[model samples]
Target: MVEVAMSNCANARPTRCIGVRVLGVSKSIKGNPVLDTVSADFALGRVSGIRGHNGSGKTMLLRAIAGLISVDKGSIEVFGEEVGVDGSFPMGVGFMIEPLELWDEFTGLEMLTLLSSLRGKFCVDHLRSTLIRVGLDPNDTRKIKSFSLGMRQRLNLAQALMGNPRLLLLDEPTNALDEDGQETICRILRDERDRGTTIIVVSHDREQLDRIADVQYVMSDGRIREV
Candidate 1:
């Protein structure tokens, strides 16, 4: 967890060690500005939370950090390496965004297997254990099309956690979950932080953020400020 406040230096750089750095990041969509010269630092091995009303650019910031969208100005760096310039994306990143695209024809286990194959690291046993860890039955052969919203959310989380990423970007991770499910997700997030994963979460639930976030920020009018 973040234990110290980072210094506001003359360079506008964070003094504490950082996992990711956003320097003057700005983005516009169809001529409407979404992120306006946002600057922030995410400390390594800490849980950072972003909260905001709808269309405040919380999701857009996460997307930009995840390398899913291009920024119109400034730069993003992960562990001191600039994204898109150093490489396409930061190493060991896991993310879950809305409209999760899944193969409706494939079983849940099969979907995990396919995604794991892309990384060429995890095996069948690893995938099965991840499924169970997320409270899903690995043996269930039901196609993804048959999954309910909550179940799909769990599956999405399972996939994000499959390989134990070093950086996690979760947008509304508790959405569609019951109280118990929410607790389970929170527990898993804590465990991940304990394991030194840098996590960035975007959620509307202030209580949830208070529970898990080591540092919190609020987004408004295409800008971000710590709170």
Candidate 2:
């Protein structure tokens, strides 16, 4: 039987070190379990990596943390605040998942502009620099539909990194990148970690995970074990 915990943040208080805590989290889709009693603590100002093969519940875990999905059991707390209690995601969290759907009619710059405007944090120059940092040509006015796979991936990353989110979640962030592109992203993530950002990354690339993750976990058979 699945266990469920009522969300409560009445006593939530900022922790000096911990950024997120997952306690007995479990989820199922259409009666098939994906996450089974998963629990982990993510330290503040560090990168945590989840490595698993396809269908091992990595993405589901991330989506649950992002407040994009409801877990059938357990609790998720971000920065000491309960996730479901408020029906709103924690502030300054950014995520990039697979199957990205962009405004094909808008230019890459335009899309980023729209996102940053919603955040109300970055200016146009900052947005342009973010695009350039992700290896996209900010001056290019071509529509997103004209972009190649790798270009689109870079743009996806740009949006996630636009506002310098306090917590960043990325799944297969280097999916279509070449060696140089992958290295660039690693450097950027490392920089963000140094600046006190908490990041969670899900990837199949063991080497990349080892290089960037302060701590790592392997998910299998709907469970996660620290490595």
The candidate that wins on TM-score is 1
lDDT of each: 0.89, 0.87
Q: To one decimal, what is the Cα RMSD in angstroms of model 1 from the true structure?
A: 3.6
On the 0 to 100 scale, the lDDT of residue 37 in model 1 is: 95
C-alpha positional error of residue 100 in candidate 1 after TM-score superposition, expressed in Å: 1.3
Candidate 1 TM-score over all chains jointly: 0.92
Model 1 scores worst on lDDT over the 10 consecutive residues at 1-10
Candidate 2: tens digits of C-alpha lDDT, residues 63-82: 99989998899999988888
Which candidate wins on lDDT?
Answer: 1
For model 1, residues 131-172, the per-residue Cα lDDT tens digits are 998899999989999999899999999989978898999999
**Root-mean-square deviation (CA) per prediction:** 3.6, 7.0
- In model 1, the runs with Cα more than 4 Å from the true position are 1-16
Candidate 2 lDDT for residue 128: 91
